[model samples]
Target: MPLLPPWFHVRLTFGDGAVVDARAVVSEGRITIGDLSAGPPAPPDGHTAPADFAGPARHRARPSWPRGREGRRLVAEAYRAAQSEGRDPVLAVMRETGRSRRRSLRLVAAARDAGLLPPRHNRH
Candidate 1:
């Protein structure tokens, strides 16, 4: 039996302020977003990702830290501490990780991707 294709739930916002919330399927080197599929996806054979994937939650390699998991945990803690202490969390992550600014940013990105950290607020 053939396995079902992966499904993604997408919310696309247009320049004209129109938003479309729809589902997509990935199959046979193609991505069919919303009602554009050539055909419906096959029934699940229990080998596909969750049907609600949003196409942005794919995992990547995790950078190693000095304290291992503890050091990784510190990224969150230090960021919070910096926020409460009125310091830059990015800088604090660098200081605590003894990592460069680029690496610190990568760690932060990973945190955000993992949903462990919320997206940063933008102030005008």
Candidate 2:
């Protein structure tokens, strides 16, 4: 006789703003599953920005912060290099970090302000 495992349920939210609910039942490593959606895809949460550039823009242009897989890899490499070389870690972390200058500067500045870097003394 084959033994049966328990059922598992999951809820997922997709990038396109769709929500899905699914369930699965397993028996001896073989599984059967079913899914059902509760409602139609929902629109993004907020009001859409005006398409026209006729009026002064209300928002300022801000550089996107690196947070994805590749970005995380770059950051890790930079940090490791900085640590091994005994340099200002953020400086090494941002040098050619593949991010915009503004973002790089902000990263370095934030690290410095947070006391991650040793205080530098002015020399004549």
Best by TM-score: 1
Q: For candidate 1, what is the lDDT? A: 0.71
Q: Please, what are the lDDT tens digits per residue for candidate 2 over residues 64-102? A: 546555555555567657778888656665554645567
| True-structure Cα RMSD, model 2 | 13.6
lDDT of 2 at 43: 52
Candidate 1 residue 57 Cα shift, in angstroms, is 40
Summing lDDT over every window of 10 consecutive residues in candidate 1, give the lowest-scoring window. Answer: 34-43
For model 1, residues 17-119, the per-residue Cα lDDT tens digits are: 4456778898888888765322223336645545654456575444557554555566888888998999999999987777889989988777766666777
Clashing pairs in 2: none
